[model samples]
Target: MADIEIFTGPNCGYCREAKRLLDAGGYAYREHDVSQPDAQALMRARLPRARSIPQIFVDGVHLGGSDDLAARLAQGPL
Candidate 1:
């Protein structure tokens, strides 16, 4: 299985959708809520240019946000 990590924020629809997609695909993932201080710092350290919630990492590869994740899922299996 791939190592999946998702950075999410409170009340984020995209974050929920991203998690749904992963769940539907039967992928196990670790979710980090940026609402917490530690997760926020970790997200900033990993993606300095990203200015959105629901940032996703697949096996250490940046997969952008929910839309990007959808596109990736459409292409094939992750």
Candidate 2:
């Protein structure tokens, strides 16, 4: 399976939904809450122009936000 990492923030609905889908699929992932000050630089590095929360990465590839992740999931497994 591919490595999955999720960049999230506080009070993010899409982040919760992403987690739900991953959990349902039994996919393990690392979650980073960008709401924290320490994670700001890292989040910026991952998504330069990202203006929203729930940015997800699969094997180092930026898969975009929750809707994008759902679209990818619908297309089938990675």
Q: Which candidate tops lDDT? A: 1
* Candidate 2 lDDT, 1-78, residue by residue in tens: 989999988888999999998998889999998978767779998678988989899999999988998899999985
TM-score of each: 0.96, 0.93
Model 1 Cα lDDT, one tens digit per residue, 1-78: 899999999899999999999999999999999999999999999999889989999999999999999999999989
- Which parts of model 1 have CA positions greater than 4 angstroms off? none
Instruction: Mark the regions of model 2 whose C-alpha exceeds 4 Å error after superposition.
Output: none
Q: Each candidate: what lDDT?
A: 0.96, 0.89
Clashing pairs in 2: none
Alpha-carbon deviation at 36 in model 2, angstroms: 1.2
* Cand. 1 Cα-lDDT: 0.96
The worst-scoring run of ten residues by lDDT in candidate 1 lies at: 44-53
